[model samples]
Target: MSQTPLLPSRREFIKQGAAAAATFMIVPRFVLGGKGYTAPSDQLVIAGVGVGGKGESDLASFAKTGKVRIGYLCDVDDRRAAKSRQAFPQAKYYKDWRQLLDKESKNFDAVSVATPDHNHAAVTLAAMQLGKHVYVQKPLTHDLYEARALTEAAKRYPVVTQMGNQGASGDGVRQLQEWYDANLIGKVHTVYCWTDRPVWPQGIPWPTGATSVPPELDWDLWLGTAPFRPYVDKLVPFNWRGWWEYGTGALGDMGCHLLEAPFRVLGLQYASTVQASVGSVYVDEFKRGYFPESCPPSSHVTLTFPATKKNKQEVTVHWMDGGIQPERPEELGPNELFGDGGNGILFVGKKGKMMASTYAANPRLLPLSHNQEVKVKPTLARVPGGAEGHYAQWVEACIAGHGNHTVSAPFETAGPLTEALLMANLAIRGYDLRRPKTTGPGFDYPGRGIELVWDPQQLRVTNFEEVNRFVKRDYRPGWQ
Candidate 1:
């Protein structure tokens, strides 16, 4: 108490800490274990290409797993990629993704494709061909054909694959399915799903601008495989979500989340019939632009699933988007259910019903009274488990090599989900101007509400030749 030693000044302390951090950064890493991390003989070297936006979060999550060391980072904009590079100082950096893939593929065990929707197939397919495990962001593929092709490619390459729909791993989503299977929601005859998106740029026609390009951006490379077009400020970075050529609209963006539980719970493989009613809330232009070129401002898509001989209850799914929602079910009390912002799937059963959001920690349902007398098995897992983190789950799966496994949202599950999601767009495109409320169960059509029977084995329509034409797409020359 008689003598007090003076502490280092803030600048002095920071300088010393900086030196220590620099020294620690160069040190050899080791495996983290309870007994104290021992150095590993081998570590999975990983590389991330699109290192900003959603990609940055993916990179950080992967880095935290400790199974892999980030060896390279790539992006078109150096400014965007800088933070991720500093986050992993040991990693090399590149502006061009192809250079990263071609030259550095040997250095990496896996590569993540977090680029735009249009470039997903090109980058991910190249990585797969290079024998790297690919973690691609969802809508998985841009169009129906790419969906089928990517699924086939995954089969050919013997590597772990995961879609970036993190909601797939949510215990809440799994519990939602389990609840449905156990008849807690009875037989779900109808599902209403919606997404509130395009917060960046939406509800307008593609901008008309002079073609003078920005120096910072490589517009040609940005276009990638899509049919060539001049650079527009409205269609870059984040706003791509609103463009048809670049992004897949709100339905494509959030459908994977909202539709995931309903699609899984009911085993909905393909829709027999799909139709749409669009308003300009305008239907004519929904599918025309970068986002909703021909899509309506507000549209409702109705999907009909035929009742197989084994199960007679016909399943019907309806998608409502553009900040629109169907009238709340009258059976449920007023304010018992609220629909606004983002997405939710309502499973309407013969008995009780349940509604849950994809990312919801605790998805609650209507009437509150349904909770009484119902005994849920309590098999549901808490939200944040050790392996439940999307990146962590994939890392754990990769380490085990072979064991009891789940693909989170595997291609098999995602295939029909994509089909139905895309069908919402299709219904929007096939909208009839005269028939405003024409898209629904038991509507007037040649096939009643069922358009074409789905042949799961063949992965195509078994009947209705005209409708089958839309199930596939013709790629533009070199792009395919």
Candidate 2:
């Protein structure tokens, strides 16, 4: 099928006309012509779908790349998306992302997907299939199926793809990755990652309002492939991250960032088997529909990794959210102690331990201390400017295909990482889960936790038959 064509709006035309007038009216001698110089060969056009919130920041950075031009802007909520148009007045705006792709396909060489988790795969898949490079926000997919699908599609398309785990490129992250490689943290067996997210619009009760939809919001488009539901303001613009239908709750929201370091350093993929344990502080929160009743409040999710060909030892990566953290590692020092609402990832190897945040700028590394002493090294390996540099690297790759670190979290690597986290998510949806066996390729539930052997091919639990329904979603009529 032919892709959508760009429809130039009257506002956009006027904006462009004004820009032309300014460019002509302003004299170059006084305006500093050097800064606005455009390379003759540099012409990589890009579009941002969902250009508000974080998307706004992404658009600004991409615009600074100089080699790329922001050609299209898309968002379902027109009111919220207004700032995007003002930020990049030259770019065209669209209420429906599909229409942006269909009409403006040829206008952009690549597409940046900054939509909610539910719409990531649909928009990314459509753009990638049409031979457009995609920079999708993490976690890459809404479900295990979408993760695998995105992985396959990436292989099929010859395009430069990157997941927006910006910290993956940070100096601290790279240093952490290097430490793992050098065996500074030897034979890493366990990892603890946490984040205090949904910090913005979290703990929202189930939305109860009139069925009437807002004039500015294309309710159906916003819902995208998720199930049909009445219009609710709580789910629009930004709050969707706390809901099951729109977002992946806290796990899906921050897992990619918290786990990126471990996954990248260890090349971790989907868990061999997965299980989760839930601890609810308030029962009424679940009953009264405070927060997404479908998701858990506080939970401990454990993923067991099988022995790989290279690293012939299995590993376990644990995830904690909603103010839960792992038992403080014995190596952490008095000053190095993590505080409340801390976001960091710990890489505990047989030798040493290291932990860092999303930016990975200031990592706390522990020496080989038996008594669990926190010793901050005076000088450590430095990672130059992390994601800021990574962004530039991608732009260079997109244009010249020449850069030192070109493997910027492409789908091949991102898919497995996303799938692993999704497994944790599935474990949550599978009711109260239990820990897997201390040893084995399968999961073992103790008392309350349910043991569900994951089948990657079928995308379901082998023994627990009920989870198959949550494997994928049925989109609304027109959306599908």
Candidate 3:
């Protein structure tokens, strides 16, 4: 069977539009003249999917670069898209991304996807299939399979791709890398990443009843690839991060930002095994609540990675959320802040320790003074504007085309990093697995107290088959 082509071959399309293409092939105005003389046609045309909140800010940042033009804006909710619409008044608008891509693929050179976790894969895959460079929000996709798929697709599609974990472009992570390379911290063997996330509700039952769908919101389109359900209040915008069908829990929300540092500095890849323990919610004085549809209130997950060239010993990475924190390093003053108070990443090495705040910002060697005392020559090339430079980096890379430039968190790196976080989620989800008891109405929690052995090649929990359902989720009928 032959697969239907998503878009006409690039070669054929260019050949068919030879006359029109020749007009755009002229030398850039900047090269012909001087600074501030770039041709309008030379600007990178972008289409933003989910242009609201963070998406709006992302698009705005790209436009601020003066080298990018927001050519299209798309979102399921008009209320959310309104600001971006006003901000980029010249851009065309669409509520459905599919329609936008189908009709405007030629009008835009790239697409920015900032949708909820579950819908990320479908939209990104479609965009890549059409040969559009993509900048997707962090935790790249909702499920393990999607992350892996997007990673592999980046190679096959011949397009520049970046995950929105902007910290990957920050200087702090590079400083950590340089320090580690210089043996400031001798052979890191353990890493702890913690956050106070899920500021929204989790570990609770879904809202009791559906609310009337808002006139400005298209609930069906908003649901996208997830299973259909009546619209509920407060699920849009941000609260959706706490739901399993829509979000990836706290890990999905913050792991990419917190975990990217260790993964990069330590040369970590997929985890060999993962185990987790999650906090439960109590519905009453004597009874604990069981909300299988929602994420836990808190979780502590430990993932073990195989030995890599950077670290000869197996590495253990710990993730905690919902306000849980690791022990304060003894080398620090008692009054010093630990991980910016609410979130942080810590690396424990044989010789010393180091920590940083969210987005790998404000990195410091243990004892504070070491950060100022130790001088290691900078080795990694710094991104122009550091974390903020992440946007321009993508823009320039897109202009350069695929295989010609490097991005901070390309899918090749993000896929495995995201999968590691999602794998921890698999353990978290598996820890809550319940089955009806053979002889009674009660349930048995069978997945608890087990270390899930992972087979990266197979993308499954080899030791716990039942928990593998999360590896690949089922999209709704039309979505697939």
Candidate 4:
């Protein structure tokens, strides 16, 4: 008690700890399991790109699994990354996703992409090429070409992948599937999905002036693969969804959630044809506003899919957005809610009707009471914890390695789903095509009243050549 020994200073202690960490060897859990098992100590190392907003929440859910370690966090906006950085203080941070993937590819087991729709493909493709598993947010990619590329890449890469449409793991869709398999909805040929989105701006002209870039943001990095543009107020955290350059508008925003149930229940794949009509804004008494860069306030798009084995008859799916909804079914009371109110999906079949809210939640037959009477044994396995389990499902799958287990929204499934949504977008975009008129100060809308015949194999609208440009967009040089 009388003798006290000299101790290293706090800085010295930190230096020693750093040295120890540098030398520590992390044996991957897969090595210990020898294929099918994972030790309790084994953790899935995750590197999150675009760690803000939804991305931030996605990482938190993964960490909640108790089997995941947030090893790296990357985002263009420092302000957006602040919370994640604080939560995972030990995680290395980067402002650019490319640097995170390029340098840390060997350090992490999987990558979670929560970036804007535009960068989703670029980041995910790089991670997959590095032999890392990936979890990308919904609407998978900004462009149809990227979606198809990822779909094909999943087949080639020996890595696990999941798209962030968590609803895919929810029991509601499975319940709908069970009922459909039991013929409760008898060969659903027509489906309607709608949402009241664009709570942000749309169908408006781009802001005329640029604002000083946020000091915490790397504006160039935020743009990623999209074209260069000056920073605009309120575009970073959100509001980007209304811009075509960075988002796919309302469909891209909520299509995955609302359309997933119908896609799964009907076993739908690529669409054979797509058609659309969009609402317009009037600039004045004499002219209708034309803002090709912004998504219209509302739109109605129809996609026809070829018959699958699950149903011999072809299927027609209609998508409505911007407060648009399908006609209410007659089976329900006039006072009853339609598609969980503002957002929902409805399936009309020859025998009966079925509907569900966003994320396919609260699935029910035409007559709500029928849900209590009809019981079909579950044909599909349910994800533990339902939607909340989506994160753990990917973590477990990544640990098991590719092909060892199935994920709910792998690129294979998500790609087709996303392609369908983006295909519908092609029609929406096509509707606004404008051409210079030979006469006075006016323009001609040549794309109006067109049916786009899709050839899934070729990834093109066989009937409409102009709309093909929307099928795939050119990326900014360095980003590509």
Candidate that scores best on TM-score: 3
Give the clashing residue pairs of candidate 4, or none: none
Query: What TM-score, to 2 decimals, does candidate 2 have?
Result: 0.81
Candidate 4 lDDT at 247 equals: 94
> Which should have the higher TM-score, number 2 or number 4?
4
Candidate 1 per-residue lDDT over residues 262-304, each given as its tens digit:
6666776667766666555332666432233533456677888
79-173 per-residue lDDT for model 4 (tens digits): 99999999999999999888887677667778999999999988888777667789999989998888988998888667889999999999999
**Model 1 poorest ten-residue lDDT run:** 1-10
Q: What's the true lDDT of residue 61 in model 1?
A: 88
Q: lDDT by residue for model 2 over 1-480, one digit each (tens)?
A: 112211224564454334223322334342354666655334677888988888888877887867678888888888877888997788888888888877877566778889889889888877765667788888898877788878877765566788888877777676666556656667778888886665645444575767677888888788889877778755667677767777887888888888887776677766778788765545364553323244666677888887664345788888888778887776665666562237777777777777777545566676435225533342444424566766666666666431334655888889988988888888777763335578886554442456668877666778776566567776667774
Q: Quote each prediction's TM-score.
A: 0.79, 0.81, 0.93, 0.92
Question: Could you tell me how far off, in angstroms, the CA of residue 125 lies in candidate 3 after the best superposition?
Answer: 1.1
Ordered list by lDDT, greatest first: 3, 4, 2, 1
- The TM-score, computed over Cα atoms with residue i paired to residue i, of candidate 1 is 0.79
lDDT of 3 by residue, 326-410 (tens): 9988888889999899999999999989999999999999999987798999999999999999999999999887888889999
- Which residue runs of candidate 3 sit more than 4 Å off their true CA positions? 1-37, 439-441
Error of 2 at 164 (Å): 0.3
Better of 3 and 4 by TM-score: 3
